[model samples]
Each structure stands twice: as structure tokens, then as C-alpha cells.
Target: MTEKVLIIDDDTNLLSGIQRQFRNKFDISVAEGGEKALDMVRSEGPFAVVICDMRMPGMHGVEVLGSLKEHAPDTVRMMLTGNADQLTAIEAINEGNIFRFFTKPCPSDVLAKGIEAGLEQYRLVTAEKELLRKTLAGSVMVLTDVLSMIDTDIFGKSTRLRDWARLLAGHLKLPQPWILDLSVMLSRIGWVAIPAEVREKFKSGESLSKKENEMIQRIPETGKKWISHIPRLEPVAEIVFYQNKGFDGSGFPDDEIAGKDIPLESRVLKVLNDLAGISQDTAPTKLDFRQLDLQAQLYDPEIVQIVRQSLPKADAENRDLYFETAEVPLNLLIAGYELLSDIETKDGKLILAKHQQLTKTLLTKLRNIGEIQGIKEPIRVRKHIVRKV
Candidate 1:
């Protein structure tokens, strides 16, 4: 909600005068030159609007704003110059994505109006992206929730993979972490095509017949195809497709893609998925660590260590900072709350397990199940509210 604006000009007098004139109306900060403006962007940024003088020493307005386009993409950029040349204006618009161009000695009121318009445009565009993400996320969750109902084990593991991926992601720099999130959320969706009995046997560590094995082998490809059709999800599909591929280049959908060639998110997911599956009942500690060590060559060693670090911290964080248990009715359940106890039928048959986060998709599944099978009332859950620093 910050309406912060930054004005950059080599002329200190002009910069100070502009600040004084509009300081009461806007949250304005003045930078003496391009370098100072960029520094402020890195240190104190996400400004809603930035205005730069076109003729600054060493760096021109186009260069400054072009760099800003990459560094703070959502910030609206404007250009001001005494020249008012057509070439400068064209280059500014094409290179810097400039929102407004002003010649020197522009009326203060006109400049203020332009600044206001730029701020509103920034707000509108960012809001639309946010809305699209949430709406898309909700729609995707519907698919995951359906998978959960059909195969609880796979869906639960996918959720665990998502949490573990998040922890590992903190140690790495990913341009699009949400791609990993979407990748993990729908990681096991490919398994939905396999027969329930086959999936159950796999979970029980039983060997599958040749035909059964073939179906299981094709899961990653099946998942990739289904996801790729969605717009803006191509990267997500790639992550999912490679989720089972070994970091050492040794797993299914066999190809030459190996060692760092595989998507990093997939490698992290691969480790976490196997780590969780090795012995689900045991504490996520040394027990899982020793098991992963046995299959060490199958994963990225650095990512393996990241998972190792995540174990104790995640357990402690959940118990101390996140979990607050409450027994609430099904209708009161909210997305993001983790179940602390098993959701089961009135006859005590297990439905959803403890520690599974309630998502909107799962909420719908819970409602449908409540109506159809009649679940136990006052469900036990841990409302996951992170304690702020």
C-alpha cells in the first residue's frame, strides 16, 4: 500500500525543488543521480513510481529506466528532458517502458497528475496479477483435492513435498518459486491414473507385475501432458515431468538429461519425496537421514544437505511456532490449517491424516465427504499461524 515515489536528477536544485513542492502530496524520495537511484531501489524500494531526468551525467534516463525495468518490474517509470526530441521519447517508451514523458519546466500540477495516474496504474496492474494467481491457484487445487480423495497417500506425500521444497528453496535463489509450489502441489497427480489397488500395493512396498510397472513408469509423462495445456504453466509442467528423474540421471522417462541438467526444483522434490516415503511413521530426523545416505548417489548432494538441515528445524518450527490445536466442526475448517488428528468416519475409519494442511480443494472434498459418509464432529486440527518476529 506504499505510494512511494523516487525522483532522480543530477541537478540537485531541481530535485530539491520538486521534492519540496510535492512532498506533502506524495511520499517522494530524491536521488542525485542514476547510481544513487539504483542503490535506493535495491536497498529501499518497490516504489510505486519513479521519475528520472533524461540528461544525467554518465547514465542516461533510458539506461536507468531500462535497468529498473528488470530490477523493479512493477514500478512505473517516467522520463523528463529539456530536449523533448522524438528519438528520445521513442527510445524511452520502447526501452524503459516509460509511462510518461515530460519536457523541462512542466507545470507542477500536470506533473502531479501524471504521477497520480502512474501510481494508480501500478496498483491496478499488480492487483490483477495477484488476482490471477489466486484464481489460478484455487482452480488447480480442485484437481489436487480430487486426487486426494482417490489416493490419499500420494496427495499427502505431495503436500509434504511442498513443505520440504519450501524449506530447501530458502537456501537457493529461484526466479519463480511459485513454479516449484505449483509443481509440488500437483506432483503426484500423475499417479491418479493408476488403479487404487496398484497404488496401495506400491505404498505397501510390494512389487508390481510387468504391466503394473509400465503404468507406474508412465506417470511423469502423463502428468506433464495434462499440465502443459494450461497457460503460463509450461515451466511448472517441466518441473513435474522431471520430478522423478534422478539428479545423477538415472530414473524414468529416460533421456540424456543428467546432473544439473535436471530442474533444481525437481531434484529437491525427488529427495524430499523419497525421504518422506522411506519411513513415514518415524520422526523426520536421523532415521530419514540414514536412509537417504544409502541412496546418496541418486540425489544432488547439496540439496540432500539442505533437506538434512530442514528436518529438525521444520519439526521444531511446527511444534513451537505454527501449531495451535483446536477441535472444530467441518464447516469451520479453513484453508492452511493443518490437521492435528485423523479425520475419519463416524465408525472410526481414517479419512485424512494428521498434519495435512487444509486447502480449499480439501475443504470441498471434506464437505462432500461430510454429506455423503458423515464424518466425526469437532475435528482436531492445528491452525498454522506463524508467530511473527
Candidate 2:
């Protein structure tokens, strides 16, 4: 596919000459005036470059250049003028974002070089933007994975945190570099600093000692330390640090900053965090004393009331299953697929396929060869067959 080049000019001879010069190098498109040029830009751009001639009838080159900038800002703008006067150059720079300014009869080599440079610039800018987007996405994914390892208990609990954060950001009309609900996500990264024994203790319904409790309280500081190296993640770190603080200036690190002073994202995070905590341990069951204890202690009273009022009755609908059981060992099968798939018996040693699925199944078979094992109920496995992509 050839790159389409649009040349806008009223002078027919000049247009023909320029078109001929680069006809072999480009797939060319042309328009005679500003309105037509704008139409071409709207309909056919993402052109690599747009070259316009100054001193045309009706709308001047600068005006056309400005319109091009507005319509297709990424399309590099080059001005061709008979005069290289100070005012015209300044106006082209300020108003047109001119990529390269050329006096009339621009040398072919110079114009070619400028065109090449402009295209390269466009590619670099585009690549840089794409890389940044991927980087941000990768960072979020890394954060999610880290959180998963930190506390598998709450790993998938905050599924809707990002959606709620985006919604709250829109409602609060957050500015660019939006700062909102990262507090909830990064909040649990502090759990990494906590000993596994502490987590196990919680699972076993044991309370932490006073010193252990104090150490747990400082977990957010650990999170801040870890994320401080990432400049873009720093704002999220700040929000994570203050997640325990309340909306009414009643909670930790006493600054008495209430209401809006509490970043909207942090406030949203606090609500979502409570919602997730309740969802994980209490789903499929009605709210009980434990849920109430968390609500009263961990959440803003107004926010809690809002959640209760807004709680959808449809949510009471039961899901298929909550926990993995032998009857639903399909998830484990998916994880251990490679291990179960291949196995070889050697002298007192077994070599399984790099695939685990076959190995897992064989192990299960040998372990329960005569006695009933994993026989309570059979699990359903869904398999799809498709041609190779």
C-alpha cells in the first residue's frame, strides 16, 4: 500500500509540478482550496504530511494549515511561501504548528528530506504514545499480579474497583493524570510486608498481639516505599497511604482533612474496599454480625448507607458455585493440564510430559487405584475445538 500525500494549492501548474516530482514516491491526493482541503483531511487522512502554498485566493495557506492542524494534528504541516518574512514565519509557527517552512521553489532534495523527517517524526510520536499506553497497561497488570500474590484471599475481590474508580473520576470531574481509587489496589501490597503467619492467624480466627497490630498498621508505609520508585505510580502511593483515613476526619494519621479534602478517589476506594471485603467472605449469605462490624468500623457511614440503599435486589440471584470442590476440579485441571497429560515410568522414577494434566490424572489414578477417590460428583468440563489460527 502506498502512502497517500495530499497537496493543497490553487495554482494548477505548481500542483502538477509538485505531484510529478513525488508521483513515484507517493499515492497522491489533492484539493484546490481550504474547504476542499478540509474535506480531504476529514475523509482520507491520517496523511503522513500535508503541504500547502501561501498567498492563495480566499483562505490563505496559514489558515488552511491551521485547519489541518485542527482536523489532523498528527498530519505534519509544511508551509510553502514566496516570502520568508518574519511575521509570516511567526504566524505559521504559532498558528499552524508548521513542521517545516519553505520558501517558494523549495529545492526537491530539501523538500524530500523534510518530508522524510516529518514522516519519521510522526512514526516516533505514534510509537512513543503506543509504548506509553502499553507500559501503563503492563504496570496495572503487574500491580494486579503482585496483589494476587500478596493476599490470595482478596486477590480477585476488587474486580469492580477499576470500573468504580473510572466512574467516580468522571463524576468528580477529575483532571488529566486522574487520581482516584488506586488506594484500594495498592492498599493490600502492604500485606506483603506482613508475615504469612499473621495471615494464617486471621484465617484461623486468632487476633494479633498489640505489637503485631501496630506493625500491621504501618503496612501502608511499606506500600509507599515499594511504589515510590515509580514516578507515575507515586500519586497512587499517596492515596494508598491514606486509605484508612475517614471522610469525617475521624480516622488515622490525624490531619482533620474531611469531605473533598479526602481525595474523591480515596473516598471511592474506601467504599469499594469495604464492599469487596463484604463480598468475598459473605457472598451468597445475608449480611450478618461480622459484616456489620466491618461496615461500622471500616467504612464511611454515609457511604455505607448509600451502598445499602443502592444494593441491587437482583444481586441475590445465586451463582453456579463459589468454591473449588472435587465436583468442580475443572479449574485445577486447567491449571494442571500440562502435568496430567504426559508420564513415563522409569526405575523408581516418573517422567511426565512437560504437560502436567496427564501426570496429574495418572497420579490421581495410582493414589486411588482401588478405593474411591474424587468420586463424590463428576465435574463438567467445557472444551472447544477450533482450527489453528
Candidate 3:
């Protein structure tokens, strides 16, 4: 694919000259001012490099490039200006994070070389991001799959928590919502450390001894330890670490951090976890809103309000949404379908729970397990239903 470059300048003549200079070599886009440049960056971006004139009509090049750094950090940035004062250069380098600084009288050859270097930098940055994303994603999948194999109840809880987390994150308009989603999915991973008999007993709502209760209480800490070793999962680890913390400085691991001091993601997770637990016991009704309201000290009050407002909408959406149920052979089962009923092992142990959304990795593992241990046929799934407008 041809690499894209964007040039922004107040001078239309200069813009035209630069476009003509590099149009043949690179796919070039031009913006007259900083505002338009930012608009283009948002809409038609992922440009390999962006060249901005330091002095512009509305927004300074430094401001524009600084904003770009926040919006698209991987896009290489450069600043060009006639005024090459020391302060201008300093601000451009410090604030804008410009990859290259050039004067207006800069030779075409020099500018061309800078563009080439900037594109190279962009390539390196994006390549590293892609690698990290894939590696972290794969590791998470492996961990969750292990959880599914060891204890499907925990896996099912994670899946449900993931769905609720996504909805909450979306409602709040949080950036990169996937981080919250991933945090929720892996939040229960520490349960693996508990003995299988203990886990089963806990699942059955059996009263636990003091030692067993302590072991259960330590699951979040154990999960944090597991997540901390993985590269690029520090945020996830932090979220998981504080999942049990309360808004009023109450709850396990006994950290004094409370209220806004807790990460927003953690606060959101705590409320959702409580709500999910409540729903599992009994279907939440409007009357239950009072119970949640009474528990305000336990959650971020603002987030609690958002959840209250969101629940009715969620209910309406769920009611309107319809899924076509179908029974498919184990080998033919595809990912992204919701399980309508529990999938159990030949010995009647639950392998996957109802309402869990299947994933590619989960499906592949299930297939492998089936081939080894003979799974029953006609696995029930809720087929993806596309609503008519």
C-alpha cells in the first residue's frame, strides 16, 4: 500500500508546492489550517507522517501536533516554520513531540529525507503495537481457556462480567473500552489457585471455613500477581487488584484507597460485580433500585446513577433483541454465538454456562476436548440475529 502523508500550512501556495514536490512519491493530503488538519487526522488518518507549519491561523502547529500525539501516537509528526527561534524549536520538540523540525527554506532533498525517516519511525511504532496487542491477547485467551477447563463456573462468570463491563464502559464513553472488558474477563483467574473441591463447594453455596474464606478473599491478589508478569497488562493488573475494593475504603486486601482514588475501571467493575451477583440470586426489578441506592457507600455514586439509568435501557434492548436458537454439531460450532443452555461433560459437569458468548479460542479448545472425550451432539447455540430496520 502507498504510504500516506499530510501537510498543513496557512499558505495555499506553499501547500500546493509541497504537494507537487512529494505527490508522485507518496499519497499526499493537504490541510489549510490546524483545525482542518485535525479533522483530517480523525477522519482520514493513520498517515505515515504529518508535516505541520509552526505558525497557523487558528491553532498553533505545536497544539495541533500535541493533540495528534494523543489521538494517534503512532503517526510521525514534523514541524516546519520560517521562524526557527530557540523557543519555537524547544516548544515544538517538547510539547508537539515533533519527529523533525525544518525551516521554510529547507531544501526538497532534506525534507524528503526527513519524511522517509518519519515514515520509518511510524512503521516501527505501529509494528511494535501490533505485536504487543497480539501477544497480550493470545496470553489472555490461554489463561481464560485454562480457567474454562478447570472450572467452568468461574469462566462463565468472567464472560458475564465482560459483557456487563463493556456495556458500562460504553455508557460512560470511556476510551479503549477493551481494556475494561479484558480486565473483567481475567478478573476471576486467581480462582485457579483454589482446590477444585473448594471451588465446587463455594459454587454450591456451601459455608466455608476460615482458611477457605481467606483463600477465597485472596483470589484478587492472586489474579494481580498472575497479570503483573504479562507485558502491557499493568493497567489490567491494577484493575483486577482493586476489583474487591469499595468506594468508601472498605473491603479486601485492605488498601486505604477509596472513592475517586480507585481507578474508574475498578469502581465500575465493583458495582457491576455486585449487580451481577444480585441478579444471579434473583432477577433485579425496579424495587431493587432502592437496595442498590442504599448501598451507595459501596460504589461510586455517579457510576451507580449511570448504572441505574442504563438498566432500563438495557432491559428494553434485551427484550427487543431476539436470537434464533439452533442445534449444531460440535465440529460445526462457530464462535460469537451465545450458548442458550449449559454445555456439560459426559459426566454431567458443566463445561460452559448458558448466556456465555463463544469465542474462537474457546470453540477450538472445545472441539479438541470433544474429540478426546466424546461430547454429545447437537450443541445448542443462539444464532446471530441481524435486526431488520
Candidate 4:
């Protein structure tokens, strides 16, 4: 495949000459000035290399290439200028992260060689990024899948927490929401360390002894330990470490960090985790918002307000529909549906509670429960109707 090259020069004649020289060797694009170059970079970019003339009207080549570093870092950058002073070269390299620096009267062969090098750099950078992305994705999938197999209950909780976190993050227009989503999914990973009996007892809402409570408090730390070893998961580990932190610095792993000192992602997770707990009681009510507010410093006030304002609209968007257990397709049991009543085993042990969102994991667990312990027929669920805008 041919690599694309962009050449930006204020001198129209020079631009035309460069394009004509390289057009046959590569897919060449020409831009008359820095502004036009930037526009092309943004709109028709992912170019293998960009060659810019240093002196231009309105944004200089240094500034243009710097913007490209932010907008398209994988695109290799080169600067051409008649002024080849040491300071100019240093500034170009430092600010624009230029891969190559050439004088205005550079020979065609030298420029071509530079473009070849730049293309190679672009390929290497993009390939590394793609590899990192796939590795991270696969690692997360394996961990979450294992968590799901080990304990569906915890997996179900993570799914709900992720849903709430995603919704709240989207509301706030938080950047890189996938990080928050992944953090929430693995937030309960520490539970794997707890003994099965203790885990079950905790899930059942039974009173825990002092030792048991202490063990529970250490869960986040355990999660941090588990995740810290994974490459590129440093931020995720920190968020998991502080997931139980309070707005007032009152929660576990008691530290001086409080208020905005806590990572924004951690604070968001804390709010969503608490909200998920509240929501499990049934769909949250106005009173529930009041209760959350009354908790005093447990959550960020701004986030709490956002949640309060969002709930009514969320509720309005969802209308209730019912379906029998056998008739309900697995795909239909989507996120945000509430259970009208307890889904219980034949022995009357509650499997899933009323008003809990019917996540895919939960639905699979429900089906497994039906196959294993057996459930009563005509299982009823309150499906949330998403109204068309």
C-alpha cells in the first residue's frame, strides 16, 4: 500500500515543485499554508508523513506540527526552513517532535529518504499502539470472564456497577469512559480472596464479625495488588485502590487525600457503587437521593447533583414491560430492566432481587439457575422501555 505524504509551504511554487517531485513515488498532498495544512491534517490525515515549511503566515510550521502531535501523533513530522539555526532546530525538535529537519534547498533525494524514514516511524508507532490496545482488551476479557465463572453474583454486581458508572460518566462527559467501565468491571476482583462462606454471608447481608469487617475493608487493596502487575493498568489500579474512598476522606485505607484530591475516576466509581447499592432496593426514589445527600461527604456534591437531575429523565425514558421466563430471549434481558419480584430457587433462596438491572451476566446466571436448581414457571421481569426520541 502507498503511504500518504503531506507537504505544507507558504511558497506556492515550492509546494507545487515538491508535489511534482514526490507525486509518483508516494500519494502526495499539498497545503498552501499552516492553516490549510492543519485543516487537511484533521480532515484527511493519518498521513504517513507531513513536511512543513517553518515560516508561514499565521501559525508557523513549529506550531502546526505541534498541533499535529496532539491531533495525530502517529503521523511522522518533518520541518523545512531556510533558517537552519541551532535554536530553530532545537525548538522544532522539542515542540513539534519533528522526525526530520531539512533546509529549504534540500535535495529531492534527501527529502525522499526522510519521507521513507518517516513512513517507517509511522508504521512502527501505529503497530505498537494496535498491539497494546489488543493486549489490554484481551487481558481485561480474560480477567472478567474468569470472575464471571468463579462467582456470578460478584460478576453480576460488577456489571451493574459498570452500567451505573458508564451512565454517570456519560452524563458528565468524562474522558476515556472505557477506563471507568473497566475499573468497575474489575472492582470486585478482590472478592476472590475472601472465603466462600464469608462472601456468601456478606452478600446475604448478614452481620459480620469484627474480623470479617476488617477483611471486607481490605478488598480494595487486594484488588489493587491483583491489578497493579498488569502492564498499562497503573491508572486502573489506582482507581480500584481508592474505590471505597469517601469525598471527606473517611473511607478505607484512611489517608490524607480528600475531596478533589481523590482521583476523579475513583470518586465517580464511589458514587456509582453507592448508587448501585441503593438501586438494588428497587428503582431509586426521590427519597433515596435525599438519603444520599444526608450521608454528608460520602460523595462529591456535583456528581450527586448530576445524578439527582439525571434520575428522573432516566426513569421517564424507561417504561415497564413484562415477559414470562421461558418466552424471554436472552438478548431481550438487557441492561436497566428491573425485576418486579425475587427470582428464587425451588428452596426459596433468592437468586436475584426486585428492581435489580437485568444485566447479561445476571440473565445467564438466571438461566443456569433454571437449569440447575430449577425455578417456577412464568418468570416475570419488568423490562425498561426505551422511548424513541
* Index of the highest-lDDT prediction: 1
Residue by residue across 1-389, what tens digits does model 2's lDDT show? 34566788888888888889878776667789778888877667778788887788889989999988776776788888887899999998999999889887789989878877877887877687667656765665566654553444544344345544554454444543234544555666777777889876865679989988787777767877886777677777877777766776666556777766775556656776655544532221245324655546445565555445444321323211222213233234443222212222323222322211222334344335224322221233222234345
lDDT of 1 by residue, 257-354 (tens): 98899988888778877877775532366767787888788899988877676554436555766567789999999998877678988888778877
Q: Against the unseen true structure, what C-alpha lDDT does each candidate score?
A: 0.83, 0.61, 0.82, 0.78
Candidate 4 positional error at 231, Å: 1.0
What TM-score does candidate 3 reach? Answer: 0.78
Clashes per candidate (backbone, < 3 Å): 0, 18, 0, 0
Q: What is the lDDT of candidate 4?
A: 0.78
* Reference-based TM-score of each model: 0.82, 0.48, 0.78, 0.70
Candidate 2, residue 80: the lDDT equals: 82
Q: RMSD per prediction, one decimal?
A: 3.8, 10.7, 4.3, 5.7
lDDT tens per residue, model 4, 1-389: 46789998889898888878877788999998888888897678668899998888899989999998888778899999998999999999999999899997999999889988988988898788778877776677567755765665666566556656666776877645667877887788899899989988998999999999999999999999988988878889999999999999998878899999998888888877777676644335676676777785889989878777664332423433322222344335565565656667788976765544565556677788778888754555655344466
Task: Name the lDDT value of residue 131 in candidate 2.
Answer: 75
Worst 10 residues of 4 by lDDT: 316-325
> Which stretch of 10 consecutive residues in model 3 shows the poorest summed lDDT?
280-289
**Which lDDT tens digits does candidate 3 get at residues 1-389?**
36799999999999899889887877889999999999998778778899999888889899999999999888899999999999999999999999999998889999999999998888898788778777766777777866776676667667767666666776887756768877988888888889988998897999999999999999999999988987778999999999989899999769789889998989988887777666632124565556677778989999888887765432434644765678988888888777767777676756787767788877876887787776766788867678889
As for TM-score, the candidate ahead, 1 or 2, is: 1
